[model samples]
Target: MVQSIVEELEPLFNPKSVAVVGATTNWNKWGYSTFTSALNGFRGPVYPINNKESEILGHKAFARVTDIPDAVDLAIIVIPSTGVAAVMEDCVAKGVKAAVIISAGFAEIGKEGKRLQDEVLSIARKGNIRFIGPNCMGFWSASSDLRGFMFPLPVKDGPLAFVSQGGNVGGAVVTSGFMRGVGFHRYVSCGCAADIQIEDYIEYFGEDPEVKVILAYIEGLVDGRRFLDKVKKVTPTKPVIVLKPGKTDAAAKAITSHSGALAGSDEAYEAAFKSIGVTRVESPEELLDVAIGFLTQPLPEGRNVAILTPGGSYGILCAEACATEGLEVVKLPDRVIAALDKVFPPRWSHGNPIDPAGDRNLLTYLTAPGKLLKVDEIDSLIFMGFSGFSIYTSLFVSRESGEGAPWISSREAFREVAKEFTRAVSLKDTVKIGQTILPIVSGMASRMGIYHEEDVSELTEIIAAAIVSGRLRVPFLVSAFLPPGSEALAEMGVKTPPTANEASAHFLVAMAEQWVASYKKPVLTTTFFTVDQPRLEGTHYAYPSGRHAARVLIKMVEYKEYLDVSQK
Candidate 1:
């Protein structure tokens, strides 16, 4: 039965030909958006089915689905609720295997809407046609290049497959994943779930070879028992990360109105997820964080963790957060402590949160994790700050403002603009602009002669170590260390012309570029401390906060625990 559902959804995701029912030439309508989006990425034949228009965005329009000359494997129905039943009938007559209903005004509205939804579902079921939604934004597929989504953003192809009950939430997750270097294999917003429930998507994604991690933003469930059953089979092999909202009474009511899904008792949902080995996160941010962990890092053998930080405060925060998540910050063995003592300065914290107080040596950051991971007590490790590599890059890009430097009008003007540059990175366009500018800067910066071959080799050694750890299946995570901010740059700003540090800065940036070239993965490290900067490419992402890092490690440990028990 599970195999049958998986086979049925195959055409829905990678249909050879698609017809957009109720497609229109009008730019404002939902029909037009879905039609154009379908044409953008979907390489197969796309027929626009519209009675009113002769053509849509250049494709010849058919008055009805049955009128299309070729068989339509999938139909995207975007007309009003009153008109969807007729389209379904036409789709059935034309042998449409699957559909995604983008039009709203269905079960989410009230009794009349529910009746309309039932009518549509009846038609679809009778025809053996499975559909996605009565009110969904749409979906995207990396395999078929299908851009069936409402808003098409540049998405990277990776191992994460996401299913969301809410359309807007699904869109947010996709866009956020794109920015943070997290990629998706597929994305679906299953609204109303009149025909195809969330469990079907989960079951299919679990079996898919392309998908390594499954993420869902769920408002509520139609059948808790079915969901638990479906997820139980998937969790032992693949990680299922979910963010289920509606914990409060008011939010529970809202969930019902939003998707016509009953927000079942939050406690029941929590206990079920825990038992089934589902990693439930509180917010969207944490959902992505945990997903990245599963995709990049290995599961720990136990809950014991080691924290390494340049500052004592970050170490303290991570330790506290680890405790809250039921993860242990294990005491370092005497040999491990003694090994680190030789590398760190005299002021370093001697305990588990290995705080090398005021140590700016690059070698310490690269070598310390090796020592910790070697010990039997430590199952995982988290580094709290950016590696010293970023400091050199920050110094490289920063130049002092002279009286008439063309880059800025004055130091005061530079300060204001610098602050704005930091602020601008939050927007999508700014990120696009930064992506365009990075390669250009990299090209010019590469010409600068090598500053220190020894430093470059040491950084290379760190990358080599990371690759080895991943090969050996050791879990390691690091906090995102951003470039210096406007304030720091201003304080360090010089008034003279370009000095010898210019060479040093270029060399530092060269070292980073070398790191990126060797790593050969998508830039997971944020460049220039902004979204626009080149990400430090590595096997694992540098997390934004200690709490996020701690939570991810705990979940990884929990998953390992489940596997341990289940295997026995």
Candidate 2:
């Protein structure tokens, strides 16, 4: 009821019982989708409210909210605009705790609509009832088994919390996120946000333990200062990534009409977001890419970077990205050079990049980046060509084909090949270079370890074990590594990408930024940034371009350093 911050929104998110006020079975209407959405995976009871119908969606229908025999924790209103106020009266009488009004024709339409929205809001406050929208898609949470969106969200679960003012944009976010395997902990399309504003959700999710990162897609905010204040308190503890797209005058006007919100001075929002350490993204893709990077990778320790690329031009492009992000491309220290010298091919670009002489398979590609992580001189790393090796690995797998060898006989073996490669390519996932992944890495600890073989996340490590234990596959890897990757892979096999993936290498830079952030240092760092395949091992928020992503990372790192110094 107009609380400064709506504390414990669990009832709204994880309700014991839910009622669809405008419940209907009309296949084409919003009411149908909204009502049925709850039943898909919601853990509790659902009641459908319809004045005339005896039954809706197979649930015993009620003529009014007051008619329900038990208390209702949440109500979803999708009735026609003219009748919503009466329904609210019923909801208040029935002692509803929260409501999500999916009705339109509100303030954005004209004066009359604003009056109707205001009347309903006043009643809601008087009853001490909190609500989400007068014009919105509602909410969805995987952990609570709730679905209150425009439609059923994919049953995916992860650590990002997304809040959006635009229902369409938020819908796309959840849909795209599901396809990309980027799971969401919560999604609130804070439509109209008549009773509960953006600030409330910002601070709520900022502290929500289930959320590692917060992604907000705002066309506009109802109260900018409230949001800024809440964000300042929250951003320091959890990363807040926002996509505020109402920069142009035309778009600003649309934002106002869409959510009845003033897309206030774009400059002010920009400055506020930056000042509070919020990661401001410009597109949906960036929102998802950065989210995934933050979720999957470990943070870097400082601004010092180690870049490994397969091509010279790609390496140069990455260097430009580094400069754009204010990341220093530190030269290879002597120890790093010596460590890499032992493994690099003839005429390799033997410095910071550790570029192979040419294109290579997963093992060789990973070996250089893996070696670079050992140097204390560098604090972060980026890999650009590792995905190409996914294609290269198949060549070795098919050398024996479906009819030939033992390891190549089953589909599981084929997939195992990729998993083996992923383990090495994803060295960042296996362990924190400076942090302990297991109890100990020393020789003494290895002997004491009960599950030493399972400790490693690499196939190369597994193969090494196989060799040591005398159960080896001789021709596949031995002769496979003798020739250089390009000739060896091509001489053996290197198929063109099944068809190109339009995704660029830019998200890798974003992942790098998020990766280094795991250390909570006042600098940006990453261990993998090499280009290719739309996937980031498994999930990422979006990838704008190396240059754009680097610029965003630069902003975050700068703010971090500023915060650290100011506090000191």
Candidate 3:
């Protein structure tokens, strides 16, 4: 059903011939940047349309869009508010596949602009054409070499794709996310959305093979039902992360003014997102963090998280933070404690977050998470602080070469030497440095932190999604997307934590409940055998949407298969 629309949107993403209406020669204007970006990225034919000049940006310019010699697959409209209607008429006459209107004076400017926006919409619909925005930045696809955006996105191909309702946030995501190594397959800033809504992009991007994860920075949704339907269909295959602003009434009002979006009740939006299996992050930082997590972290086995750190206080701090988020600072199980005694000294604080008090080796930092992952008690880990990366980095360089210590011309290095010479490496000093500069090094960038954080996070979600769908390597997972019943969790001997560490287990268990819930109602009074393996993937049922009788028949078939497997 959506394939038709996907086909319709194909040329927009990768066009053969693009015509720029209101093309300009000035570098400062958007008309210049938007069109040039296309020329810069795409190797296809580009035509510029301008009234006065013979040429713009060294490309042959035409007075009207209909004068282009070839079929215009995509048009970038950048004319004035009053001139858009005429431009749309010419675009329709030319029979272009789609046009991206990059002008600003649309419905967001109020009634007069709303009427202008409607005129363009009416023409596009009647002309059997589709367009992107009349007040937005437009879109880009790395695979197609299609950079229709005003921004020069990083030259990288990432598994993530983002669609933002606001152009500012879209630009911000491209610029800021690049520094953190987050890239995109495609990025679209859906401005005004006069012709296309957020849901259309969701459906389009969901079908994108290059896109493994979808991140949306939405101010509001025009059609919530359509959004829910499309997201429900797509989420089982790819994780959709949305950062919806306008949570407050004040912000909601602002959202309407910005894009004429109907920012409905936040509560309704939350429930709708939840029901459709969308992961909603509250802030930009969480959006990026969770996006990275989805891209890199592993599926956690259980809810009990063990914080691995060099300092006891850092471990305690992590414990406090984890507890606040409903995570369990698990007491180190007897087996793990017994096992750690070999590597840890006699004074090791033998607890859940087994901080071997005096262990200062960076190798210890490197090998801790995998060693901990072996224990069934721990499902995930958050490494609190790390070694002085700058100091460790110095070891590989020529700076600390000649004497016991290198001749330091820099005052800062000499100051450090004097301070370190006079003071001893005390417990308080370790905690102090760990809390201060050491955290910056290990926060997410240090070698050990990057490996563990990325590994544990991506794996946990993948396993979570796999456990729910009974399909490993299902494109993406929603953090904490499940609501499994207590009976099932009890059967697995799992105590679901309030925080997100156990989210994978919760995700799988919840999906299983959704599939078997209706069937189990009939046998509520009876009991059945259960599986106890920490990962109960067999229980995760990938039940596609169907009628009630059809579901029952599926369950019956599944039961027969289960019996066969059990017998074998």
Candidate 4:
């Protein structure tokens, strides 16, 4: 009987019972890793198929998959390449619906390997069984709690569905994305494409309701025409991002051996991707940046953007970047400039890239973006500068008696902190404290009781949820100098002074996420300082540079145009 794509792939993700065809007791072996990892809270029964051992990892062992008493929905084959064909035959006899072959030494090795891979594929096909790989790491499904991968990943339930031709690369993206607050609904390591190819997974993810955006790392294509046909149907409704690395001949040669995939004409692939509205990124960083932009921000109505920077240089830099990326650095209308004048000082740039010229007021930083976005000419806004909350919060105030000791008496710590915050930061003309800067201020709002230290993470989520839930109609990308991850910030010791830039990123995400949700726009951010580790969490990420933000916006613009055209 013919099966739908979901029907064909469902067991691969939500299998009721699984058999580890090469279960082993050796810690170094792939079979051991696969079976042991699957036992970590997999939703259903996991049986170990091994002849020598009575049991493996506390489960009864079966000599062959067919010997298992229960009907197997999925079979995980991690035996030698020479033994994979036999394992497939046993899986076929057992009426297994899907299999994930994690063993190596397949087509990537050479002609003999290719012949073996073909033989295994033929057996699986004849038995109406679909499989993941002849040489793969394995797959992970968040919905089913299926952990079939060899490597361990701190999987979080999210909207992204990532498929990669390279296992290590896929693992890296998944790991990096997790550190940066991106999560995955499903992650598939497509090894050698012996049977189940990358395009097949794309079509399945496209149909899966859990997925919002699809990301792919392609070394080469198995069938270019089939990929195009399948991807074309998925792109109009959802975004399909691909990072193809075979642009140069040297890279193409490396790719050929990497996954045994044919590195087709790079130019032809580019044209096809463009025609089908697939967002092609240059690197893994770009891939994640574009993915975050899509998930967190709304598409801009047009290419016109208004930039608000804390310094003249960032304004100039961002303006140039936006123009170079084919986005219009829109000229501020007289009314818009007039509106900004009320918020910024006399030295403000007063032009398109509105430079506050070292305006240290929290009110000004919070108010600037809304002013520019209100203009009809501006479809998007880029706030570039010292926009982190650490600058204005009392967290940096000395808690100990030392060189940077607290200014107030110990009896009145909270009150003194609140008083000191008001004094250091200019809250002048702040008509309504709660409406103006409730949660983004990142301190205890003693008067309004709107913010507290304990609620920092929750408030941050509120900000992100606001942006993600369509708070802004146009995209809003912010930049910071040194935005640390949430863990890094939380682990920060009682220091003399906080990393102002890092704190800026911490608060920038909160403000941006909140503002985006309020306005129903996308708020992407850039960072200047190096965060040697991944620390930021939730939907907010501090991209390495402003150019990264620009690239994200441009890609979003391109996707928006494609969607618009497709709808028409």
The number of the candidate with the highest lDDT is 4
Q: State the weakest 10-residue window (summed lDDT) of model 4.
A: 473-482
Which is the winner by TM-score between candidate 1 and candidate 4? Answer: 4
lDDT of every model, 2 decimals: 0.72, 0.65, 0.61, 0.73
- How well does each candidate superpose onto the true structure, as a TM-score? 0.78, 0.76, 0.69, 0.82
Among all candidates shown, the one with the greatest TM-score: 4
- Residue 47 displacement (Å), model 3: 1.1
Off by over 4 Å in 4: 386-390, 394-508, 532-538
Scanning candidate 2 in windows of ten residues, the lowest lDDT window is: 496-505
lDDT of 2 by residue, 288-386 (tens): 766765565444556777677767777788788887667988899777677555545558887765676674533344345445655676666666543
Cα lDDT of model 1 by residue, 349-463, tens digit: 8898888887765445545665676667877777666533444433333333312223444557655644554343334243433433333233322333222333234334444
Clashes of each: 3, 19, 15, 19
Please give the TM-score that candidate 2 achieves against the real structure: 0.76
lDDT of 4 by residue, 220-316 (tens): 8778899989999999878999999888999989987888888889999989999999999998878877998898788888898877666677678
Residue 187 in candidate 2 has what lDDT?
86
C-alpha RMSD of each candidate structure in angstroms: 11.4, 9.4, 18.2, 8.0
Q: Over 4 Å off in model 1, which ranges? A: 1-3, 387-538
Pairwise lDDT winner, candidates 3 and 4 = 4
TM-score result, candidate 3: 0.69
lDDT measured at residue 38 in model 1 versus the true structure, 0 to 100 = 89
Question: 1 or 2, which is superior by TM-score?
Answer: 1
